[model samples]
Target chain A: MSQENTAAKAAPGVEKKEKPERDIHNLGSSFIFKPNVIDDIHVKAELGRYRMRGFSLFKKIPHFDDLTFLPGTLTRFVIEGYREKCETKTILGPRAKRPMELDIPVYITGMSFGALSYEAKTALARGATMAGSATCSGEGGMIPDERRYSEKWFYQLIQSRYGFNPHHARLADAIEFFIGQGCKVGMGGHLMGQKVTDQVAEMRSLPAGIDQRSPARHPDWLGPDDLALKVEEVREATNWEIPIQLKLGAARVYDDVRMAAKCEPDCIYIDGMEGGTGAGPHLATEDTGVPGIAAIRQARKALDDVGKTGEISLIYAGGIRNGADLAKAIALGADAVAIGHAALIALNCNKDIEEADFPNEMGVEAGYCYHCHTGRCPVGVTTQDPQLRKRLNPDEAAERVYNFLHTLAVECQLFARACAKTNVHSLEPEDLAALTMEASSMAQVPMAGSQHTVGRPDMTRY
Target chain B: MAELESRDSHDMGMHDEQLAGRTQQIFFKPSAEENFTYPGAYEVDFDKETEFDAADMSNKDVNLKIRDLMSQGYGSITIRNPGAKHSLGVCILNRLQLTFDGSLGYFGCGLIDGPNVHIKGRVGWSCAENMMAGTVVIEKNAGSTFGAALRGGDLVCKGDVGSRSGIDMKGGTIIVGGKTGMNSGFMMQRGRMVILGDAGQNLGDSMYDGTIYIAGKYESLGVDAVESEMTQTDIDWLEKKLSIYGLKAPNGVENVRKIVSGKKLWNYDNLEPSEKKLIL
Candidate 1:
């Protein structure tokens, strides 16, 4: 078959004929493909996975504007190569007043241990720690192996309530009580039986091969008040030493944040509907939860209304890709941001193992194929296959994580410089303007300048 | 309207007689006194087609009224399309106290320990769906899979329960007055399902360590249930049970087909031998 015909048939309509065929490598397949000939093949954003054939066309779009950095003005200047350019040290502990403590603002978002191999969890913890950031354990419990790499670790107390590790008292820096994750709010997680290795099966207390069904609601506590009590129980169990944060998907976030505030939690991190998952049910990932930008605004309002604004730090996650998002979130009153799928990419997941035709033998195009719930992750990050996992070298992956964190920090500094600000927190609505009118209104920030200023921002809230 | 329905000759003669028999058999006569009594107890008066508006009821009064309502033994008081825009929020009434008063029969929600219950009448899926004391019985044969995950309590069906009655009962007894469609005790761990009539296909399919006694013939017994030794103790238990249900034990009580297995479906770690025998 002609290469063009084969490419067309491989993922119909997603790719078009190109002139200067570029050499493309994946699992076992090798082919020459031209980027431009493929209609609309301008995807330049090199972050995130592109799983289904449907999104490959968008992959052709370019991401960076020639590594654009913010220009330094007299007000704010960039200080590089100085012995003391800026102190990079941060203190994170569970007992601090700000309950949800973290070494760096960047943290590992929730990705189930069951969805990932033991090595993946270890690598994440190891990588996150190496990067001076914290890693949050997903619904899965605090595995002993993962504990070794834990310096600043957040344990997700999922609704499933699996893996109540005794050392959770000691190893955990903070207890993140997950009310509803953004990807699947008002739903339970479905860990297919095939993924349940003997170890995973024992940890989750389910049969080795029977599909595990997390209850739709919590087994013990039923409502917000009950969750408050459970939070108290954890506090007492940990001798009032640990700070508790409540994490919930951003759907009906108005009420959710209100309830979280009522619970008197130290931090409320909202995961926008766009949150990434190693593998969520198709319906949930595609259609559930509110977008992140709006969630942050709602959460901020909720906390402000209760006069608990600074008392509980607000963090937002879901589909956050670049420093611009970081800037927008802070302007929306989010204290920090957490990332999941991005962290995985930094760990070098979804990469072609041997530089072959496809990303992996699974015919998964690349990053988008995070259907790890099937236990057949073409790349090692999301699978239990020891051989596949071997392809992922933790040390190298750890460096990548460190590099990604460093890059994100640099980008933050650049944005701060542009807005004539020093600390990220210093960037306010007045300093920055959104690109879109809708974004400007939703963010409660002004447009580019006074010329486009329509009304006092307080009068409108989308 | 309810009074008129109760007086209807056809409804009275057939349904009332059957209910009376069932009541005598299930409740151990001189039954528990009607414990609950309150105004606006039943939303739907037995004969009335229209249901009582749950909105009219304050949450405070819902439980109390439902408690009293269940005692009236209305055959099929349905909370039609619950969890809908115009449906009553879940209300539980403890053990339906009323028997076949006829009036087209009452006997709805019996022994509601606590569950948002909505009964579509002529109900027959184990009056309780894994009822831990809560019950919702239907006057008609529950199609099948009644008491599938019955945890506790009694779900007495007035009509034939179609197949797989008490399929995976952990605790509780489902006494089907008529017949069991099939696979009656599929994986019943710790419960007794007394089927009064013929049982359908693969009855007690691979049933592990539970007692399913069918008064009539069983079409097929599944992978687990082999014949078990029916001892004198078994006969004695059957006789006592049948007498309560107002039925004499089948002739030659000494000879009865019993299906038994020690295998447990849930805990695969524990597997025991199967002993099937006709004990005299």
Candidate 2:
């Protein structure tokens, strides 16, 4: 080839690299980051982007109307901080004399070593410690520094067990046997072999480039009875000194909770349909599992039915944000809550920043970028790039985590006070009245405490 | 008694010695914290460094019934021939500590868990299933599905593994010095599986994902799975793991292939050839 021709071939976007071209299902990276892209199809309209569509027979209409909160009655007076005083000090895990102790309800969820950077895992532990709560290390065993943070750690033992140090066998404060995650139930986790570093490969104990796969059901367990037996095995190992926890995706909440209660674990954690992941097939995320609300309500009722109401604490996750959400969750019978995406928000992940070496035009911004499917987290929160990881200081990030938790607690406290409830658990459905029929009925709150009005509160207590 | 006395002073005194009680009183007590008891009426103290004298001790549920009586917070425990005359049948299910130096070793095994579990003989498959911690060393080969769904622990085999070794393995390390039959690392999610010898064909076939590393010649790689490029990160990782397994830096290891499943497909269809190449 001539020099001129070679120069043309080497030009930026033009290269000889042959990308496997296909017209197969293009779930591609398109929907991975953007929300509701499934509904945004481009179609011809009479009046395009400018004017109202001229020939359109149907127009977009608001789905609901006039939602309002119930006003306080004379018997139930609102306290200070109509701007401030509600309390949200909810406890997760049965503190009912269980051998294990977890100080905060809001804890970090599980993220595997292969899925995240070692730096990210360490940072999560640091942040959880800073926040005065626990961060979970995934099945990849205990990295040395991770073990150092064991005081504030919840070790999630996945199917592919790694980081298991015999000397540190008794270290974990709690044990969580990951069943089905909200993202994908019954499907195995896959870390693209290309991404598997030798360390990652070694940690997983596989041939260098071969894909790693976990079985759908536990090898020894076939059903709930088997699961309980396994739970007993763990209990025996720890001498019943640490609380055992079971984490499951919200697929069949009633059945799942029922089975979990049989094992008598200290807590049952539920992650809903919208659970986030570093990477997962699009079909699994969008098409699988029930939503968080249905799962939580069904599970709570299941617990009550089985006479295990206070036996196992219930924690709900999947797309939670702010004080109101926390209150709604508690009102729905959740003992506490877990935060994944919201935690990322607190850490300011996916930020919009201008840099010389930008990869794409659609700049990443906090809360909007779900580009974690690729290992390139531009904002340094999710990527494995050493330089980027250095940008985040665990100590500082951990402080932010602490601050966020502290602030959320204050807000919860304020709400509890407003409803005349001294404790968070005391602020019940009786104190809550939703503005929308959807929320009121879904939350099972007795609207108006009377009839016919979703937002109206019964003033008889007045 | 007079005839016994004429044989020898020692022999005459043997009956007297028996009357004198050579063995210490082995009292069995209930665990102060629990409602359970040792159940069986036999006890052996290793401090006498006594070789285990029991011929059929393996079939009993030891961890659930007798483990507490042996606790002294010591570093090592060796049980000789516990299963020599009996089928262990879930007796030592979760009681081996082969990895931790201060562990309880059951000499003969049908099933075991935790502590440096050195099996001087063969172990039944599922020997280390769902083991949360410890080491299981099998001097002989294991049956099918060994270390299946193993969460945390180490399983080191001195001999070949039967079919489906490390199947659906989530987390933990399984090192087989000899060759592994078919279905090794099948449906592996997370964790490293090091196979020193040649692997049977379709090593990770139908596998949705996870990593697999083989150091021998491959008759055939899995479907939708292709060779991945070995980056510097991969090199460093290989070196570290090699050092861990007491092997050299893997700088000149022969036929070291990195087989990878691509990012696209949920199972096998999307596995594309990787860009990096393994020199060895």
Candidate 3:
């Protein structure tokens, strides 16, 4: 009996008479309740809450890859890449005096001095200056090194007003009123006590060893109208010499852009849902905000609807990786684009670091690490510890960032040449076609191999 | 004083010119060759009769005009019939004395570094928001968000103030003589607020490090705000502030209640499980 049973059980295709009972205690894997879902349930059950901390959003949302450029073919002549000169120069905030002119259309987005190491911040400034672009002063305030290094800088006005000073405001080339970020639209900025080093505390005007939670909204202004007043105040403060920019997360893009335009800002910056942050609520980062493609399209439409098409500049950010993404963003009507996570990656973040180098309590490896909020970044991109931060030499990191930016511009020129555009800003929606219906609808472009656009009615068919 | 007399006659002549539809008035014109330098002062008098309209001129032009007058070495200026024009006196970086005879609109005297701004009438929202230093005195009621995000300054409001007053104030002294609207001193990091009148609800909500002195009744206190004993040092400071603003305390110093941050709401982990709902 044992030999026959064993032979039957061992057979590859045979079923034994007494089959192993399904493990009822461990419920079978369910598509509806995935592993992460189950794990989240357990976490909530143990913690008695759903507090989004440390991790970013995990859900995959719509992105720019859904669309493809319709390069010039037989009907149109594609410019020769090596022989032709494709312009990448960009001008921002032309409506105001002292508009920022850059040699390239790509810029370094804001990363606060507190959130990133001093070396990382300096590296970004140096790299941006070398690349003939601008770097932004993120949340806390403008550091001396960054201000001295960056030729052109955009100072961010976060809700918390941490380290905000009028003297610094006057020194900036432009001021950006940070309404929200892509990763956490409705949430405030969070800096754990561990990251609040003495320098960070001084910069933010807070006591050391205290956690900081920036307010979600501006303290004085509540809505768009109030924002208009605040903008006027800032304009008066600057003597109308510098441009003013309004930045927002990509949610309700059309309405927000319209409101922001009415406020008469020189530029509007929209960050898509795929944006990264030092720390954010997991659910907010994942579940909230629209993608870059949709945001750019809607922002353009809003500007057009408000009769502010060329009167105000539009800047796009979030998940912009390379030259192709830059070209696509410009084609979708963004005057310029900003880089964050990609720039960090170029600076050697989450790379070339051994697991042993990481703090033992972190329990993470190089490629899968995201402990920026803990102030224990092994690669030193987001740490405050002197020893850890020393690992990233600003000179070397600046060279890498400069190379990355240079390569991105070169790649963008190639795309622009193939699209038969002399200037990157001249690239239009007509040069693009959507590969999927969702993208076609959002982008208002015709589907590939189809005569009809998704959102608009086809008069030819009618 | 003789210059003042000459200026008075010039102002009258400008008023007649204004009636003749020649409304543009350049009090102290700067030559193109002149190089403007700081640490100077101004004493130009802007009046409605002269048609020196803050509303019609660009902020740049007004600021430039102010700068020019200051560069000419005038130390004090008086404005009459302000009529609530927005941004009347902004970005003045000198140590001048600006006196407004009438009500001003939004952002009046905003971002002044060293100027002593005196508003005789009510002010619009954000009277001195994000102001760095110097003194801002409002004789009447103030709109919402009065003295918001003030880093280092002295703001004295003689009458009632609207909601969210002293919000996000980093380092400053705010003295309110009358009733205050809701959410006063919210998220204040390091500052001193002296309220001699009744205070609205949610006083000192989420404040990090600050001292609030209230002599009158308060509606409610926000999370992490609690009353503490009023020490003698607080009374002396209050007295000094009252004297600076030329105000009498509404009640005895013994009646003033001192409020400070409880330090319990600084971290989320410090909150009790039941208190988590308050944050959410």
Candidate 4:
């Protein structure tokens, strides 16, 4: 989160410019009390409740952009950029009998059907299939088409158990136990009444048009010990075939992950504070969990400590925008990455399409809109309205999602090959160097021009 | 590495029945037709009865044996000395008459769609969790979270059940002949829970849309749960449901207390501006 700094110097032939005259009447403004902050207080005072929105955290954090790849130079031999093979094929939950194999290391994360339109959900399913990746039936249960279109599918057993069906679960390639989400660490999911149509209501077995507030705790099991027994139940149900993954929000990463490992899940998914939500409290989104850079490091260390590194796979999600982010995650210790907001962007989430009147309909310009909670998405990706939904063509959207996923995989390969790693999974922490001290400390990687990592004792001992 | 068995919608029977309009996914194209042909679902005969002992077998072996028997058309099956095995008799989707002479550990009879199951002994936590359409009956005391997230069919426990029983129950009839522990019917959405004996604290807490009928006194009510006037319809349902399991309320069905959601928490921001501002 370092701000850009530049110093001004006058040319030899030009005269130096004078500083602008300060207004004597002005006592000057408080940098701490910025206009946006003041406006937020005012809005809250009026609303009498916390503001809710659909997007990733607005505040900046130490992120993938702060970490730069130090690819092969003189010491190591580089693989050919495009010609040589850089294996993007990834496997998660290797210990499971039927491990989830992906052609690419990235897959679309779960976003519930009630929070999104049918077209958007199916399009993602079809797209992920085409990309040889996977799609998760997020919360409100499995839509038939989403299941039919997806080659590899994850059935999420969220706390709410909304529309959670064993028939649908039995059809899954894997099961995701939604213990928590990154966007709202300890909170449950929220789908505004606007989007809770009759179809969604029936699926979740709730009254339609009622604001759906999912429970944070699972109805059956309460703790990790019970979770172990619950895992056994699912394993027995699935005939011990598909993998069972526990998706945990990034909080007390080391301890939480250690406990999760004890539960004996095939995979552990860590969702960072930077993760986007279809709808969530703005405060929770900005302030809840640790950032991805830090979360992955702790999670990996926890797995290593537990002697389950190879047996239990780690999948990281939150604030991943492009290939470099995906590659950086793997280097930091993630076996794979999951993308939600980025995939939505690829599905024309904020695009200024022909049918979209963004400013008029959403009260913002195309790129500025984050109104998925409103169920009035101008681009049709997050809406249930038939007219708005028609704005998105599932066929084209599916292709775009495929293209986006493909580009990310290829881009991730570019970094891997440059780093002289034939396999994308071979991109290790040694290939990365942090541009900022926060990144250096959090990611536990060295600074850009130095061998010194901020938090490592050896660097300070000297 | 091994072949996966197919689990169909209750029956391998609903051929060509569209996933009903319940999904509200009307934009489905003819090309991407919903395929209901779950290839590996079994067709069994009820008259073909068999019994086995699962005293020494692992959960995987026991479940596999049951499925194998079903595949071979042995529909009415019994397992003796189940030995309090966890996850026993799970995810049985076919219409079979299954019985267990002994007790089951946690998650017994869970995720089942169509089965008439009887457990002669007690059951542990989360028994019959997410059962779609089935009759799961326990003769003795049941543990916590009994029938959690139950979707349909009849689930009965003649003896007392622990806390959070029927938590998040969707559509089903849970008739507990004995007392129930705290938070019974917590967050219940759609269903009828009939607790004939004394109900514990926080009865029918935070329910969305459901009815709870308790013949005895409830220690306390949880948030948004309130008592309502019992009608003839409630009496009829209680009487009919109780009779099926040969359960009679100590007090008459008409004297049973009814609890339902107050609809206050249903739409949190239904107060002022956008209802979307749920802080979760």
Q: What digit string (tens of lDDT, one per residue) describes model 2 on residues A397-437?
A: 55566677666666665666666665666655566554555
**Tens-digit lDDT track of model 2 for B1-280:** 1221232323212223221111211221112222123222123333322123234443344443335433432333555544432223222323433221111222122223344566666654455665555566766666656676665667777667776777766566787767787767666555667676778876765444556667775566555456666566655776675565455423343345566554433423233334112111
Error of 1 at B238 (Å): 20
lDDT of 1 by residue, B1-280 (tens): 1221232223212223221000212212212232113222244344422233443443324333444455454423333222211112222423233322111111123223433333334542223433455434444566555665565665666567766677656566667667777667765556677766677887776554567766678888776576667778878987775555455434444654666654544332122323222110
Residue A258, candidate 2: Cα error in Å is: 0.6
Candidate 2 — what's its lDDT?
A: 0.56
True contacts kept of each: 0.00, 0.09, 0.39, 0.54
- Highest-lDDT candidate: 4
Compose the digit string of candidate 3's lDDT tens values, residues B96-163.
Answer: 77778788888778777778888899999888887788899999999988888888879999999989
In the order shown, the candidates' DockQ scores are 0.02, 0.06, 0.19, 0.34
Candidate 1 Cα errors over 4 Å, as ranges: A1-101, A355-360, A450-462, B1-280
Cα lDDT for residue A200, model 2? 67
A145 Cα displacement, candidate 4 (Å): 1.0
User: Candidate 3 vs candidate 4: which has greater lDDT?
Assistant: 4
Better of 2 and 3 by lDDT: 3
Candidate 3, residue B45: lDDT: 36
Ranking by TM-score: 4, 3, 2, 1
Docking quality level of the chain pair in candidate 3: incorrect
Over A118-232, each residue of candidate 4 has an lDDT whose tens digit, in order, gives: 8799879878887889999999998886887688899999999998888778789999999998889999999999998888888899999998888999999999999999999
**Pairs of residues at least 3 apart in sequence or in different chains that clash in candidate 3:** B41-B74, B42-B74
Candidate 2 C-alpha error for residue B161, in Å: 11
Give candidate 3 regions above 4 Å deviation. Answer: A1-27, A48-56, A354-361, A459-462, B1-60, B275-280
